[model samples]
Target: MNERDVPGWKNCDTMSGTTAGTTAVGTSGTQALDTREPGAGFGEMTRRWRDLTGESVPLPAFSAGTRAGLRGRFQATRLSDTLVVDFAADSAFRTAGTPVAGEDVVRLWIVRRGQWALGNSRTDNETTVSAGGFMLRHVGRLTHFATPPRTVAQVFVLPRTLMRERTVTGPAGTAELRLLVAHARMVRRTLSGLGPAGVEAARGTLLELARAVAGRRFDDQEPLLASPLAQAAKDLAAARLSDPDLSAAGLARELRVSLRTLQRAFSAQGESVTGHLREQRLEAARAALLTAAPGWSIADVAAHWQFADASHFSRAFRARYALTPTEYLRQQRELRAR
Candidate 1:
C-alpha cells in the first residue's frame, strides 16, 4: 500500500514481509489477527511497543488452557498528532507504564470485544470495562488491564496538548462512562475511514468527544470534583505528579480557588498542600525507582517526577523510607527472588 492510503501516517515500513513481523508506527491497512498460527517474536514487538509509546508493557502470563505467544495483531495510523491503533490479542495480559519521560499518553480506547480491568493512580481502585465500553486516562497515570483471549480493542492515542487546551481532562466517573463508550464507538468508526485531510477537518468533533469521555457527566457537563476539598486536592496532586510547577498555588489556580482557600482546605484535612504535594512527588519517585527498567538511571526517575535532582530525590526517599533509592530497589529485587 502507498503512503496516502494509510490514515494519519506517512512513510510506512514493516519489519516483516507479511502481517506477523514488527510493524512500525503506521499501518498498511487494517491487518486482521493471525489466529491460524501463533504470532512469532512477541518479545521484540512488545519492546518496539515500549519504544513507540514510552510504556513498559510486561508480557502476559499464560493462563491455563490458553496458548501463548504474541497473538496480538496491532496496527497503527497517525492522524495529525494523534495515533489511532487497533489491537486484537488472543491471550490475556496486563499493561502498565515505565516512563522514560514523565509524560504518558492520554489513551481513549473503544472496547469491541472482551474486557479490561483498569487500575487508577489517584486511588487504589479498579474499573472493569468490557465490550461496548471506553476508557480515558490522564497523562503519567499508571493502569493495569487484563485482556481475555481473542480480545479486540481500538485505541485512540490522543495528544496531551489537545487535551490540555480544549478540554478539562480528568478521570471518568462510572455514571458518565456508559454514555462515553457508546459515543466513542461511533467516533472511532468515523475516524478509521477518514483520510488525513478529513481527519484533520474533524479535529473539533474529536476534541469534543474526548472532553466528554474524560470529565463530562451524563448531562454533558464537566463533573465537579468530589467534595471534601482536601481529597480532591490530593487526587489532583497524584494525577499531576510529574509537573514541576504543580505547587499549592498552581493547584489552587487549576481548581479555580484562591491559594489561601486551597491551603486551608488541606489544613482542614490535617496536612498542608505544599507538604502533601512534596510527599506525593517523593513517593512517586520512590515507586518509579522500585520498578525502573534495566537501562533507566536514578537521574531519569528524579527528572521524571520533577525532583530537584538525583541527590535531592535520594535524600527525600531515604528520609521517608530509611533506605536510599538504590538500596530500596535492591531490597525489592531480593524480595521478588524469594
Candidate 2:
C-alpha cells in the first residue's frame, strides 16, 4: 500500500522498498551491521537500516547541523528471523521512514539510550519516549521519530504475518503485551552472555512473545519455526543439556512431533536417537568447559550438561577431546593467561 493508505500515514517521507545504492560494509553472516563514521552519517544510517528491514528510511534535519557534525553508529544483528537494531546518533536528527509496502511486520522500538520526540502522521499527535519506554510500530504505516544529540535506541523488528493487526495506540490486552515486550527486550540485551546456550529455545520463545505482543488468539507458536523439524528437535535437545529431564520422548512431545515421527526423522539422517542425544550433550559439555565461569566446579559442569556425575562427564569429555575435562579447562585457562 501507498503512504496515504497506511493506518498512521504520518506526514513523513514515504518509505519505499529496499534501496540498492548503499554498500554492505558491516559484519557479514548474522553477527551485526554497524555504521560508524565522522560527521553526520545520516545517509549511511538510513541505508544500513533499510538493508536490514528492506524498507526505505529517509533522514530529516533534526539538529542544528544534522547534515554536518552528526556522528555515531547504528548496529543490527539477526537472531533467527528477527532483526535487532541499535542506533546511536551523537547529533540531533529525525527519521522519516515512508510506510513499508506489502509487509505487515511490527517493529518493537525501545528507547534505551535517549529521549525521543515521536510523531504520528495520521493523528498529527506527538509523544515523547524517555529512556526505558518502548512502542510498537506497524511496518505498513508512516513513521516519524526525532532524537536530540547523543541519543541511542534499539529496535526489535519481528514479522507479524501470523497475527491480526493491532492499532498503534490501543491494542487489546495491554498487560500481556507489556510483559512480552519486556521479555523480548531482556532476551536481546543478555543474548551475548547466553553464549549460544538455549538459542533454539530462545528463538522459539521469541516466536511466542511476538505472537502474544501481536495479540494473536492462537495457541500454536510455530509461525516462525519453519525450519526442518529434525534440526529443530536437535536444537531443542542441545538447549536443554542441563535440564536432565530432556529425552527423546520428551523432545518429541515438546516439539509437537510424535515419537514415531522423531524416530523416522532420525533414521533419515542415519543416526539413532540415543546417539544424537549423546553427541549433543557431549558437545555442550565440552563448550561449557572452554568458557565456563572460574568457580564452576566439575560437578557443576557435569550437572549442567546432564551427565550423571563428574566421573561420567570427565570420561565422556576425554573420549571426545583426548584430554580430561580438568586438563582441558586448565590448559585453556593457562593459554588465556599467557
Candidate 3:
C-alpha cells in the first residue's frame, strides 16, 4: 500500500496497518501507510507496528506537538480481530456522540507520560490516572474521560474472551485501575538497556501489569512472605542482624513463642532460624555492593546494607560468589555490554 492510498493519510499522522484492521500508531511524525498500495513509508511503518502490538486498528494520527485548548471529541476509524487501540499523544482527546456501547471489547487506558480522568455514568465510578497509571473499562460500557491539554494516552480495546482465557480477577463488578509507577519505570529501563532483546521482556511486563491490576498476585507476592508468622520473624531478624546477642532465643521471646516452636517452623524450610537471618543480611549486603552504580565505592554499598565492616563483607562475598563484590559488578556490566 502506498501513502496516497491511505484513506485519510496525512503528514501529521503516522500509522501502520496489517491485514485489514490491525494498525499501530507511531509517535514519530510521518504519513500513514496504505498496505493495499505500493509504497515504502506507509508499508514499512505499518509492518513494524504490527510486529510490536499483537492486535491492530486502522490508521491513527500521531500527535505533532499539537495542543487541544478546549473540550473536544477525537474520533478514528479502526477495527481489529481481538483488540483495537486508539492512541493519541500531546493532545486531549475524548469520546463523542454517546458511543454505541457493547460488551465486545475490554477498554484500557495507559497514561504514557501524562495524566487522565475517566468514569462511567452507568456504574457511577470514576478514576484518575497519572503517568504509569492505567484504567480498565469493560466492553460495551458507556464511559467518559476528560484530560488536560498535552495529555498522552494509549487506549487499548481488547476482547473479553482474550482476558477470560488469562483468568483475570479483580474487584467484583467494577473496573480495575492500577498505578504502576515502579513497574512502568522498570519496563522503560529494561527497554532502554536491552534494545531488541527487551521485546519479550516488555511483553511479559505488560502481561504481569495487566494481571496485577486484575488483582492477581504474581511471584512477587509469595504466600510465604504474606504469612503473619513469617513476616514477624523476618522483621525481628532484620532489626537485630548486627547484634551477636540476637539469636533464635531472642526472636522466639519477641514473637511470644518457645525456641522449639520457632525451630519447627524454620526446620520446615530446611533452614536454621538464626542462620537464615544472617544469610539474608549478608545477601542484602552483597546485592547492594554489586548494584551500586559508578562513582559509588564498594565500601559505601557494603555500609548501606549494614555489613559488619568492609573486611567482613569482602570475605563473605568472596566465599559466597568466588569473587569480590567489585569484580562481580565489573563482570556483570561487561556481560551486559556484549
Candidate 4:
C-alpha cells in the first residue's frame, strides 16, 4: 500500500524531508494522518504513523493478519508550544518502545473508549489506563504501549523543557487529571471557532492544566484551601508568565470575572494578585537561572521571565532567596561541579 491507496491525503508532514503525499488537517500546523481504508496495509500505516507521531509500530512476530487488520488515524494539532493528538482505532497494536531522536515530549494519554497497557522499561512497571482514565509518559524514555481494538484517545504532547519533572506516575481519577481531560476536550471541540488570541489563551489553559496533572501541583504558593477561581487564575498566570503585559486585570478579563471578584478570591487566601504573580515570576526566573544552559546569562533569564531589567530581577531574587541572581547561579554551578 502506498500514498495512492489512501484517498484525500493532504500532505500534512511538517518535519524536514517529509514525503510528498500525506495530508494535514488545519491551517495552523495541524496534521492529520488517516489509515482507515481497508486496502491500506499496516506497512504504509505504520510508516506514516512513525512519521507523524515519532513512534514506531512493527509487525508482531506471531501475527499474520496484523497488516490487514490495522486501521486508525492520528490527528495532531499544534497549540503554541505543545501538541494534542486525537487517535481512534479498530485493531490492537503494540509499539517497539524505541526512543525518537530530538523528540523531547511528555505525553498525557486520556482514554475515552478503551484501555491502554503501558510498560515503564526503567522500572519494569506495568500500568493500565482504562476508559475515562489517563496516564502520563515521557516520550524521551523507552516505554511500551499496547492499545487494544476500539480504543479512542487523546494524547497531550507537552515539551519536556516546559515541565519541571521528567515523568510522574500515579493512579487515575485525580482532580487535576479530571480537569485536564475536560479542558482538553473543550478546547478541541471549540478549536476552529477560536481566533488567534483565543487560541493562545486556550493553549495556555491546556498547558497549565496538563502541567498541574503531570507535575502534581498547580502552584506551589497557592494555599491548599484557595478557591477554585484563585487556583485557576494562578494556573493562567503561570502559563503566561513570559508575557511582560500579564497583570491582574488581564487575568480577570481572561477568566471572565470582575477585577474585584478576582482580587477577593486571592485576598481571601491572604494574598494579593500582583504579589502572587511576582512570586511566581521570581521562582520561575530562579529555576531558569539554576538550569541555565551554556551562553545563558542572568539578563536572559530576567527578560525571559518578564522582569523589567537585570537589576530589578537581581533585587527580587535576593529578596526571595537571600542571594543575588549571579550568586545563585554560581552556587548552583559549584554544586553541580562537585
Q: Compared with the true structure, what per-residue lDDT tens digits does model 1 show for residues 1-338?
A: 22223222222333221112222121223332222243324344545554333333223333323323334556654433455566776556554322223445566766778866655421333665577766666534344455777677776667675454232323333333433333333334454455544555444444554564565632222222112245546656777889777788776665555677667666666788878888888888877887778889999999999888899988988899899888988898999999
Worst 10 residues of 3 by lDDT: 65-74
Candidate 2: list runs displaced more than 4 Å.
1-55, 65-71, 75-107, 110-117, 121-134, 139-143, 146-165, 168-213, 217-284, 287-297, 303-306, 319-323, 326-338
Better of 1 and 2 by lDDT: 2
The lDDT of each candidate is 0.54, 0.55, 0.48, 0.64
Identify the runs in model 3 with alpha carbons over 4 angstroms from their true place.
1-103, 110-113, 118-134, 141-156, 161-298, 325-338
Give the candidates in order of TM-score, highest first.
4, 2, 1, 3
Clashes of 1: 2
Off by over 4 Å in 1: 1-28, 32-39, 43-68, 96-101, 120-125, 141-143, 162-199, 215-338
Tell me the alpha-carbon RMSD of every candidate: 20.3, 11.6, 12.8, 19.7
TM-score of 3: 0.37
| lDDT digits (tens) for residues 187-284 of candidate 4 | 55565666666666666666677777777755533333135557667767877999978999997776555788778878988999999999999988
For model 4, what is the C-alpha lDDT against the true structure? 0.64
- Cα lDDT tens digits, model 3, 1-338, are 22233433244433323233223221222333333333434345544454444333332332222212221122222223333233443335454324343335566666765576655542333667777655565645435555665565555555464354232323221211222223333333333234332433333444444554556433333222112234456656776665667778887666555677667656666777867876887777766665568898877766665666778778888888898877887888899899
Clashing pairs in 2: 10-121, 14-98, 15-98, 39-70, 40-70
Models 1 onward score TM values of 0.39, 0.46, 0.37, 0.47
lDDT, residue 12, model 4 = 50
* Regions of model 4 farther than 4 Å from truth: 1-39, 42-68, 73-75, 120-125, 141-143, 164-166, 170-172, 215-338
